[model samples]
Target: MTEFPEGIESGFAAARQIADAVLLEGYVLYPYRASAAKNRLRWQFGVLVPPEYTAQGGEHSHQRTECVMEARQDDRLAVELRFLRVQRRTVERATATGGFEPVERLELADRVLVEWDEAVEERIEILVPVEELMGEGVQQGFRLPGVGETELLREDGTAVGRLVRRREQVDGVVRLKAEELPGPYRAQRLTAVVENASTWIPRRRTPREEALPRALVSAHLLLGLEHGRFLSVTDPPEWARPAVERCRNEQTWPVLAGPDDGCKVILSSPIILEDHPKVAPESLGTLYDATEIDEILALRTAALTDEEKREARGTDARAGAVIDLAESMPPEVLERLHGAIRGLREISAGTPDGEQPWWDPGNDPAVDPERDEVLVDGHAVAAGSRVLLRPGRRRTDAQDLFLAGRTGVVEAVLHDVDGSVHLAVTVEDDPGADLWRAQGRFRYFQPDEVTPLEES
Candidate 1:
């Protein structure tokens, strides 16, 4: 085990908060009960099964993360790997001979305990100086031994039931290495490979649940720098863009995390996330299902029947906390969850008295969408211009593929507040072109995503 450098913990407070959510992102769903079919099939992201499982075409047995950083030879890098360890909890009833016998469920005076496979969070941290990584690099192996425990259930000194918990052994290795970039800037590329090197071998066609005990669930990495700053692999600078693109990340993507621009910390997750992802302040607590919105889940949790809530409480402690949170939430908190508006600012100066605010285009007299023109392929593409849509490869939406090679008439050439130009066009083949024109609705695209038709 490697000790983290001083101030590492406090410096990564915000990033850790988001990473915690990632660890338990899909641990459970809205219903939050063990019996839920969705809950039964768990650990969707960052699952590293045994090598034997991978050999049989199961999930990969390793995650590789490669990222860049601006650093000096003396700078230090710290890697923290986090994941979940599955623990099987079985309930047993007291036998007539004063012994306990395994059972599916155990009924107590006030509550019921059911057999469930729970998860225990685990983490491993290691630190290394950049100079060392730049030289020979480092490889560290870690192991978590299996554990078993039994708790006797007694009411007023009379035995009723018992709970047995067992955890399987898990082992892995973390390899860290760095290379100095060839550019003029002082930068280095850090490579980390986390592999499940456990000795457990799967039986022929073993089920996922049977192999999960030896697996790493929702595994992710939180990387920090002591005296250097990590670059955004998703949005690197022009000089570093080539290096960023050259970086290879397997089974995970690295993004900026932590407060204020996310330069100090990088969170490598199996689930894709935008740079500087934050846990919304309006969120009351973790629901263990990040796919669903917090408001909807909170409302749905509140609407659960008493029986369902009871089962949820028995399912997991985290689920019980969610139920309690929803039931006791104040009116104001619920209202806050209803909706939220962000990024609004006061209108800037030099606006007409009755004109629309600066947020709207009408406030700027010099800007005219219909009259504006953008140069595309040496031709002015403006209103009434026919062009073939050549959607960019990096277009955000997959539906853009459906519009590939389609023809459209430019309705307006618009400029956003961010200074980016957008061509608003109506599809020539769309039957609702007239209705779209009347409603002032148009599809917008960048200049590079369209080619001028030259009046053909």
Candidate 2:
């Protein structure tokens, strides 16, 4: 373990929220119960298995990240590697001979313990000077020792069962290298490689489940800078574009992190994210799924039956926390998670106070959904335009297959936040067509998913 200066450590902490989200991205899925088939296959990203296992076409054994940064001779770099270590948990029952036998389930007065695998968080930190990395670079090796523990499941003083947990030893190395770019700017390319060097060799044809205990799960890096700033790999400045292009990143990508002030931190993650990614303030806590909607998962967890909730609580401590959090969330907090808007533009110059804001379509004179037009098959399609729905362009939803070749009357042309156009149509023969039109509830399809029926 290594410590960073106060200023540097605080900068690193700014990136911790999103970094932890990536670390435990899919630790558990919705429903949170261990019986769910999706829950059985955990550790979805950044898994570094033993080299021997990966040689047999198993999950990858390492991750590499490379990025460009502007630095000075006196600048210092701090690196932190975070990952999860899988821990095998087993339940045992006491037999007539006073010996404990491994069992799949151990029921007690209050709860039931089931045999399942859990993750234990692990972190390794290193701080080095920029000049040191410019030459021979820095190499740090780490190890997590194997250990086991047992807790007796007792009733009023007599032990009826026992819970045992074990963790396998894992060995790995973090190597950091930096090279000065040949451009006019004082920029350097930094490369970091995380490799799992565990000595446990797998037997021939061994399954991944058996080898997971000795692997480094969900490995990622957090880099902090002192007296210098890191350049954004996703959207670097024009001068640094050439240097960014030369950087080769394997199994992971790097993005600028921390506040919009100088870029003093960079997060190299296995999960892809745009520059300056921030965890939503509305999020209550860790739901173990960052890619999912918080309100939806919270509602689903609250809807689980009592028995299912009990089983989830017994699965792992984190899962139990999730259950408690969802069940006890206040109405105000749940309401906050419903929706949030960002990047609102400042009010236009000299606009009246009672006028609609800039985000509202009515604020713009040229914006009118009903009269907007889109070109499909070399013809302009607008309101009241007859078109044939050919919903096979992308086919994102299964319902699209059933809507193929259906005739529709275009009611509006909608534009999304991403600048893509969509046509809101009402099926020509649908019984609810008039009702849907009146209520403004129309089906939306991309321009490419419809063929215009207008004359040339």
Candidate 3:
């Protein structure tokens, strides 16, 4: 005979044996936890033995045949068996659940159920046809046509039976019973295979080095009055010098005092470095004091880092815009404009002065008229009416003082039909009136020198 391939020859032989065993005795292979960490197998059965075979001495032969058939049934059996071995080893070495127990049997119609409860909290059950077990036994010589439903009670109240049939209406069903069985059955334990594989790996942490306290203490000691005052590090005034020294020496402290009453502080770190300082007494003068100290500390910390110095310089440049506006405006105008600009700058980066030009309504021509007439929107002028005009330079101060001071000359007089005389007045500058410093047209001047300007 030509040499057959080993794999093909073996497969054919295994299939032949399985067919023969099935024809004589029925067996059903059921899978358990094939996808689980612990692979497991189960066999359900229904087998029959011909009466003539039962009479012969062939029981052992049939038993061997059935075992061989089972061994060769599936290609995955080897892998399944290996998985089972690993699972068993894991269970045996586990800190939890490890032991074994007695087997139990149940019979119904054409099927038989075999079950065992192990000490490791596992229950294993198998169902096989009654005919398979009987045929195997008879083929090896024990004489009975087949196994049949016959009850055998255990020492405990639990019961057991065996059954066999060639063909019956109840071919597939097998029922099993056991009480107070330890669990975490073969089905349950095998589930760990997938769960373990899917678990997340934890991240490792870096080891931390100890901080040098002596260097920190030295830097703190060098902290000066100016630095301490701004950052609000008011440590008995005496401690100020030491704190700055400590900051300087250690090179790790990320913040220092601002220029105010030392209550404000600035972060030295790159992330928040370019932002403005946080100070308690807020104002240009107070902030200037705090920032000066902050800059000194920043200079020491940023000595080797050009990037940090650049960030600090940028912050200083932006802050200068606000200072320029303050110096240019009058005190009263500065106070009001600062209030408004402070709110605006919070919503935008640039100063309000740079955002728009200053325009005062007092300088608008529409609202002001010539001397001797009333003007409406700068379009029409009405003569002989008591009107207010912006005075010329020479008499502006006196005029303003007269209006504000409520004492001045009647530069011209107008008699109305109602007999109410309106006086046009000019007032000269008084040495005593510091308030009347600036000159204007609507202001009072000398009554004797009054010269009326014609309405245009």
Candidate 4:
């Protein structure tokens, strides 16, 4: 028998130390790669475990182990092994073989066959190249496998090999040919390809080019508005600063050449309103004449000015102030105002019994002392006993006094034995002690003397 060198022995010892460390943690080892040359050795490492190893029950315990070795003189001369879990049927084959064959020639298959009842542990060993083990003290580095070329089909139904490197030229545009693949598979494949090739690929803009005309028409419509007239194309309002910045950065203009051309034309001239009732002189307004580019330029120059830009900014600020005021109004006030209006409509319709005394035809309540009782419209008063007061010009002094000019409708009216009428009116003013003071007392009016006020 040939004796191994001292260096080879030491290298194998180091490999064993590594295997022991990993196996202590329950890892299994598989067969190692064999050396192609007589003087060298290869290494491989693998491991597997049954599902029971990670299961909850104690009855489902499993086992696993692995080992590795390197030649003493050569670091490259190393070997690794990994054991895999297998089904009872798989184990029976090796047992039935009577353990007569070499361990490497055992009946165990490459893949694991798990048994549900219990987890099983496996052991493995690795072998490294002798030359690498001797020189570097380590061997068997990891490597990824390479992918092979694939065949593909073009959009026109032409089949070709090495599709990844193929390209098609159509109408000055270069594009990749569509390859033959399953529907869902092709979709995902195309998405990945497009993402990877985007940096080097040129995109088509036919849709954008078609939409240019519509965008220009929208701009012209904006130009027709009064607010748009005040703005300058050369110097836009501060509120429009962001849009201007975007246009400048994107360089997305209708026309590219000349200072008066491009998107600036949108702010340069008034959009001639053919259907407008107002008429102007021939030279005053710019017409939509596509034939004359000079006319468009001249009109643009006349419309945009520095003063107009300032006016546009001022209008923008004023609009913002109005919006802020509207938003700040209390929600309760609006609700009350709405309720008041609804109540007034109900009162005007009158109750099913009859109208109130204030609106009744007999025993009408009047402000005049001489007329202790007067007749009023039967439908105008509720139940012929109480009167309703409301704010706004249409309401009587009883409603108007309490509500002031803050528009609302009266909800109810109470009358005392002393002949005084109490009015309940809703207004948009803030609710507080001062609100009542701001509201005056209700004054009665004679039936004949009362006059209906027009709606504001």
Q: Best-fitting candidate, measured by TM-score?
A: 2
Which regions in candidate 4 have their CA more than 4 angstroms from the true location? Answer: 1-4, 14-18, 27-76, 85-456
Candidate ranking under lDDT, highest first, comes to 2, 1, 4, 3
lDDT of 3 by residue, 1-456 (tens): 223334333432333222222221101110111121221221111111121222231211011000001111111111000001000110001112332223333333322233311011111112222223222221111111212232233324433322121211111111211111123321100000000111112223311111100001001101111111122222323423343233221111223322331322222221122223332222332112221342332223324233322322222232223233333444554343233333433234344655321233234343322344422345322223333444344653553533443333333343343434334444434353334423322343332223334345
Compared with the true structure, the alpha-carbon lDDT of candidate 2 equals 0.87
Residues 379-455 of candidate 2 have per-residue lDDT tens digits of 98999999999887466777767888889999998876557898999998999999999999998889988888864
What local lDDT score does residue 147 receive in model 3, on the 0 to 100 scale?
Answer: 21
Each model's lDDT comes to 0.87, 0.87, 0.24, 0.24
Better of 2 and 3 by TM-score: 2
Q: Against the true structure, what is each candidate's TM-score?
A: 0.77, 0.83, 0.13, 0.13
- Model 1 RMSD in Å is 7.0
For candidate 4, what is the lDDT?
A: 0.24
Q: Model 1, range 247-364, lDDT digits (tens) per residue? A: 9999999999977764878899999998999888899788888778888888899999988888888777888899999999888898898878978886575556666564776657
Candidate 1 has which clashing residue pairs, if any? none
Model 1 has an lDDT value of: 0.87
Question: How does residue 65 of candidate 3 score in lDDT?
Answer: 7
Deviation in Å, model 4, residue 107 alpha carbon: 29
In candidate 2, which residue ranges exceed 4 Å CA deviation? 55-58, 203-205, 341-389, 393-422, 425-439, 446-456
